[model samples]
Each structure stands twice: as structure tokens, then as C-alpha cells.
Target: MYSISIITVGMNHLAYLKSLLHSLYIENHPKCSFEMIYIDNCSKDDSVKFIRENYPEVKIIENKQPLGFGENNNKGVFASTGKYIAIINPDIVIQKDSLDILLDYAEQHLQAGIIVPQLLNPDHSIQYSVRGFISIKTLTARILSKGKDNVNNKTVNEYLCKDLDFQKTQFVDWAIGAAFFMHRDTFAKLGGFDLDYFLYMEDEDMCLRCWKNNMPVIYCPQSTMIHNHLRGSSKLGKKAWLHIQSIITFFRKHGIKIKNSKEHTMSL
Candidate 1:
């Protein structure tokens, strides 16, 4: 039997955390025994006390100072005793047997260093969780289009890989970090996520490294989960700036040159 570690980092999102915990408790994973590792980033709410009183079985780590997403997750990884780690967000709710399904697929696909399940929106619509590499032009188009569904735009379509049928599992360039799964050895081999990325784009960086190392990053559509889908950067606030900074860091670190390319015709 494989032992799995489900690591989550939280800061003041008590309601979401509670919902996620409830969902995990109700979900079944007959193939694996799992442990929950919760890292509290010095939340202002009563999260610490609540977890202690309600979920005593959980291994909780309290940080005096708030740490970045990469740093906090790294801490949880270090403390984990499982062979596999599932890094998930507080707003995500796993579907019944999703964990077992993911583990089954991972066991079959030995070459895949990372695997992510299909994500659904709260309304049951498919969320485009997996995406191709990011570029300045793609980012600009996404920002300008805003809420007006740019699925028809060439850059946006390519960036989001709108042409593919998400129902069929395939290899993807990267998937959102909201719910990520990987082996402990693979994570350690890559040195985990880069500390330079405070929050956003760390997932992309990790996937890029997997590609560089000739390891596969797979998208498994058989299993699914519901994500509350919070677009923090869409508000164009401090979170947005952090996103842009992470993008710049990603491009610089990968030595990618931003260039304007002629737009192709949009397709469905």
C-alpha cells in the first residue's frame, strides 16, 4: 500500500478550508492510505485553533511569518512521509474516488513525473486548467479581452489549447497548481519549486523543468474535481502585479525573447 501526503497551505480562508477538509474526509481512496499536512501561514482568522480542536489527526505547522506559496509548500514537502504528494488549494473539492483514480493512472504511467486531473468549475462547466507556455503577447491579449471569452482569438486559443478535446487525456505543457500531484522523488530531484517565484507561475516553472529533464507531465481526464476558480489577478490589483512579475521572471530564467507574431485566424 502506498502512503500519500495531501499538503495544503492556507491563510485566512477558513470557510474554504473547512469545505475542502469535509470533501476529503468523504472521498474514498481504497488503494492508498493518506495523511493530511496543513501549513498555516500565520492566518489572522481562528484557523489554527479550529484545526486543532476539530481535526486533531492532521499534522499542523504554524509559521510565525507568512511564507510564499513555494516556500510554504516546500516546508510541507520536507515534513511529509509519503511516497507521493498531492499539493492542493483550499478551494478545491475532490470528487468521490478521484484520489484512487489518479493513483491508478500514475501507477500505469511510470514516465510521467507529474499528473493533474480535469478541473470543473463550481457550475459544473469544464475549467481549462491545463495550458501551454506563457508569452508576453498571450498575456496582453488575455488581459485586453478580459471577460469577453477570447477563445476565438488566435493567441488566446493557442495559449489555452482550445483546439484540443479535454475529455481525452494527453500530455500538456503545464497545469494549474490549484491541484497538483507528483512523486516525492521527482520533486526532490528537481529541487522542488523555485523560491524566486513567490506565488503564481511556479507550476509552469516546475512543468518546464520536467520537460527539460525528459520527464512527462500528464493530464488525466478520467478523474475530476471541483474548483472554486478564484482569478485573483483578474482584479488588476497587487495580485496582478505579482503575476506580471512572475511572468517576467519566468521568461528571463528561461531566456525566452518576447516577439510580436502575426495573428492567425481564430478557430473553434
Candidate 2:
């Protein structure tokens, strides 16, 4: 069995953490095959004490200074002893057999560098999880067309972001960072998520690296999880402006030309 390490950065979501830990502990897999690592991001609340008291088996990294998503996960990854790495969010609860299915898929597809499971909303509705390559046009359009909601017309087009059917496996540009899994070797070769991103775009950066390295980012729909997205930033005053900044930053770093080509830029 491939060793798997589950990494999570905890915030103030204690209730969700309880549920997540319960789900993970009760999972019927071989206990020796997997380990859980929680990097508490200096939560002001009682998150640290809660984990230490409740989940003594977890290897806890108490962060004195809060590190963003990229850095915290990097810290956990470096400390992990697993051959496979799973970056799971505290708010998400994966299906019981999801990890087994994902591992099976990974074993079958040797070229699959990263695998994203089907993500669903709390209501069990399919969440548009996988995405296509990034550029600048799609980035700009995403900011300009905020809340112009249409299920059939999602902003991303390259990797078929609108496709929610979880019946088949397909290649995609990137998967949502909410819950992601990849081989430890592939992660090391790609240098992991770019720490410069701070919070976002790291997953897209990793997917880009996988693509550039001739490894495919896979969407395995057979395995699925529930993503309880907060959309906190979207409610902020400068949500639109901040999104634009990230979009431009993505294009500038990737050297994508927006004026001449019609390629989609990842903005979410």
C-alpha cells in the first residue's frame, strides 16, 4: 500500500474540524497506510488545544506565526513521510471510499501526476471543480462579469469548467485547491506550490508545472468530496479589484499573451 499523508491548515473552523477528523478516523482503510498532519495557522480560537486534546495521534505543528495556504502546506509536506500527499481543506469531508478509488486510479494511470476528485456542494450538487489552462482574457472577463451566473456559461473554457458530470475520468488544467492529491515525487520535481502566491493560484501553478513536465492533471469523478466554500473574499469590498490583481499576476508570471490569443485565463 502506498503511504499517504493528509495535510490541512486549520483556521477558526473548529466544528468542521471535528467532523473532518471524525470522518478521517472512521475511514475503514488500513491505519498504518495513512497519516494526518495538521498545521494550525495561529488560530486565535481553541483550535490547537482542541486538536491536541481530541486527536492525539495527529502530528500537530503549532504555528506561532500564521502562514498562508502555500507555505503552511509546504511545511506539512516537508515533514510528511508518505509516498503520496493529499492537501485537504478542513471544511471539506471526502466520501468514505473516495481515497481508495483515487489511489486505484493513480496506480492505473502512471502518467497522471495529479488527481482531483469530484467536488460537490453541501447540498450534494456538483461543484464546477476542474479548470483549463490560464492566460489573461478569461481572467479579465471573470472580473468584469461578476455574479452573471449561468450554469451553462461558466467563465473558464479550456479544461471544460462547466462540465459537472462525474461519470468519467478526463484531463484538466487545474483542480480546485480545496482538496487535491499528488505523488510525493511529482510534487518534489515540480518544487511544490509557488510560495509567492500566498493564498491562491498555487494549485494552478502546480497544474501548469505538471503539464509543462508532460504529466497530465486528471479529474477522477468516481471519487468525490463535499466542498463547503466560504466565498469570504467575494463578499469583501475589494473582491473585484483583488481578483483582477491575481488575474494579472497569473498572466505576468506565466508569460501569457492576452491581446493576440483567445486562450482562457484562470481567475478562480
Candidate 3:
């Protein structure tokens, strides 16, 4: 039987976390055994206590100090004992048998090191999770566009791969970190996520490494999940700054340089 470890990092989003947990419990898949692991990032909302009291089956790890996204996930992975580790966000609600579908697809495509499900909005609209490699022009366009629908722009179109049909499963350059499933051995081979990243772009970095190691990063549209995505970084303040910093770090590590653009660019 296949085994999976569902790992999720929590902050102060208690209500969403509870909803996610309920969704997981209700979604049934008899083919595989799974365990839930929650890593609390020292949330002030008593999230750790709530989980322990209500969901005793879930293994909880309380972080004394808040850690970055990659570091918290790594800690969860270390505590997992499943063949596959699923890194999921607190705000995501899993669909019925979604985990089984992803696991089945991953088993069939043994060469794929990482697999991502089709992410849907609460309104049932498709969320474009798969994306192309980030370039200076693409980054500029995304920042300028500010998360609006501007696929008409050439750079934004290419960056978002607007030409591709997301209804079909295919190999992708990378997908969002909102949900990621990887083989234990493959994840270990990549040395987990690079700790240099604080919160953003770590998904892209890991997918890049997967390609370098000759492992395909797959996008599976068969399985779906609803993501309560709040583009927190796009709003303003420290989150936006952290997002920019991660972008710089990713580009620097990959030897890609961002040039100043005089023309107005669109956001993604």
C-alpha cells in the first residue's frame, strides 16, 4: 500500500486551517494510508492547542521561533514517514479523492519528481498555477500587472503560459508552492528546499533543481483543490518586500539579471 504524509505549515489562519483539516478528514481514499503533520509557526491564535485538543491524530510540531517557509517544511518532512510528502498550505481545501488521484498519477509517471494538482478558486474558476521560467521581462511584467488578467501582453502571456490548455496533464517548468507532492527519495536528493528563501519563489527554485536532476515536474489537471489565495504580497508593506527579495535571490542564484524597464509592465 502507498503511504503519504500531508505536511502543512500554519500561522494565524485558524479558521482556514480548521476548514482544511475538515476537508482532509472527509476526503476518503482507501488505496493509500496517510497521516497529517502540522507545523505551527508560533501562531498567536492558539492554533497548536486547538489542533491538539480537537485533532489528536495529527502530529503537531510547535516551533519556538517563527521560521521561513522552506525551513518549516523541511522540519515537517523530517518528521514524516510516508513514501510521498505533500507540502500544502493552510488555506487549501482538498477535493474528494484528490490525494489518491495525485498519488496514482505520480506512481504511473515514475520519472516525475514533483507533481502539482489543478488549483481552483472558491468560485470554481481555474487558477493558473503552472508557469514558465522567470526572466527579467517576465518579472517586470508580473510586478507591474499586480495580479490582474492581462494575458494580452506578450511578456505576461509567455510568463503565464496562457497559450497552453490547463485542462490536460503535462510536464511543466514549475508550479506554485501552494500544493506540492514529491517522492521522499527525490526530495532528499534535492536536499529539500533551499533555506536561503524566506517565503517566496522557493517553489520555482525547487522545480528548477528537479529539471537539472533530470526529473520531470508534472502538472496534473485530473485532481483538483480549492485555494483561498490571498495575494498578501501584492497589497503592500513587508510581505511585498519579502517577495521582491526572494525574486532577487532566485535570479541571482540562477545567474539571471533583471534590467530596469522604462516601459510600463503588467502584473500577473
Candidate 4:
């Protein structure tokens, strides 16, 4: 069996997908033995053809109908034969030793629910991928802070985990779904992502479940990757509507609790 299974879903992300695939394969970024799985979400572009032609070794799961992020990842996990599985984005470029670092940490902290590396922008600035468990109050304050520059963005800052030191490795509430790692057993135990979240908020729900189950969410700064973040939630119509719907579903499943990140921290 492979040491790690890297899964990524793409919908017309041909350019980004090429960079990611090249970095993983041609550059041989991962140190451990791995199986690559790419889920094509009914792309209108020639993404499937390119993968089949350029990287035949990569297992491709093509969909007739577009699927959600969580569903695509679950499908990849179902097809994987690795001890560890990473559900990442097509826009992320992996480092040679990134997976090995996370694997070493996972070996030591076997109970970790989700482990994520530091995500950097193209210019090498840190992305706010790590965050505390988002509460309704924090969400409301973030919306309110959009227009006012002088307003204290403390609530939003805390929600993004800016209150904590970003340089040090620590247990956090959650990380973005762009790059999430977990053992196959842990994923099976958690039942994977909740189907209730069709688009967004699935990552947060999974991490919240992890915390509820006393499993730590590890943030390893030493393992860094570059992510070309496409902020779909910031879009005007459909994406925004989906985000709102997911938020409602999340709150329905688990009530809007306003606990801090310190409360969720484990002995790790």
C-alpha cells in the first residue's frame, strides 16, 4: 500500500492543475510513496484529457454531474489504498519534504484528527488558512468591519487565529480544506465530511467534530506549501448563496457556540 494518497478536485482549473501535478510528479515533491487521484468535477475544459495524456499514472475519477468538494474527496478516499490521505486543492504546489514532515508528526501524535501545513501566497506571505472555531458573533463582526477601517477587527482576527502566534506549531480549531491531512482510520472513524455541507463549511464541521471527539487539529509551520486561493465565497451570487446555506446547515447541526481556540486546545 502507498504511504499517502493525495486527492484533488478540479472544475476547469486546467492551468492550476498542471502546475500542481508537475510539482508533485515531475519534481517528485513527496518523499513517501504515494498514489495520486484527481477528481474532475465535470469540467468543461480538457482537464481530463490532459491528465490522461500527460500523467497516466494518476487515477482519474470523472463525474457526469458536478459534485461537492467533500463528496469528491470522499470518492477519492474510497478509491485510495494509502495509510494517510490528503484532500488538497488543485491550486496547491507541494514541497519535496512537506508530506514527510506531516507524516512524522502524525506518527508521533497518532490521535490527531486533522493536520495541515502552512499555506503561503505566491509572494511567500502567509495565508489565513488556520483559524479558531468560527462563531456566529465572529461572523457578524467580520461583516460589520468591512466598511470601517477604524473599527477594531479583533473578533475577526481571533476567528482567523491571528491572536495566536502563527510561526509556532500548535493545535488549532480548523484549517482550510485546501490542504488537509489525516490517517485513513481517523477519517473512517469520523465518517468523513458531513454530506449536509454541499460546498463550504465542511472543513470547519470536520474539525469541530474532531475537537468534540478530543482529537487534536495540528498546524505544522515547518511544512509549507504555495496555494493560489480562489475565494469563491467572495463572488456575487451562487457561491455566496452556497456559503450562506452551508453556514445555516452548520449552525443547525451544531449550535453557534462562541468558544475560544484555547478552549479547544489539547495537551499537544
lDDT tens digits, residues 67-160, model 2?
A: 7688899999998988888999998886868877777777777777889899888999887677666655565555455533342344544334
Model number with the top TM-score: 4
**lDDT score, candidate 2, position 200:** 63
lDDT of 3 by residue, 1-268 (tens): 2389999999998999888988887554425799888999989999988888888989999999999999999999999899998999998999888888989987877877789999998999887777888887777887788856555678888767777688877778888899999899999999999999998999999988887787777788888999998677876789899999998899889868422111213111
Looking at model 4, residue 177 earns an lDDT score of 87
**What Cα-based lDDT does every candidate model obtain?**
0.82, 0.75, 0.84, 0.85
Write the residue-wise lDDT of candidate 1 on 108-215 in tens digits.
Answer: 776777888999989988887888787767778888788234457888877777776889877787889988888888899889889999979899998888777767
| RMSD of each predicted structure | 4.6, 4.4, 5.6, 2.0
TM for candidate 1 is 0.91
What does the lDDT come to for candidate 3? 0.84
Point out where model 4 deviates above 4 Å.
Answer: 146-152, 258-261
Q: What ranking of all candidate models by lDDT puts the best one first?
A: 4, 3, 1, 2
Which candidate's lDDT is highest? Answer: 4
Q: How well does candidate 3 match the true structure, expressed as C-alpha RMSD? A: 5.6
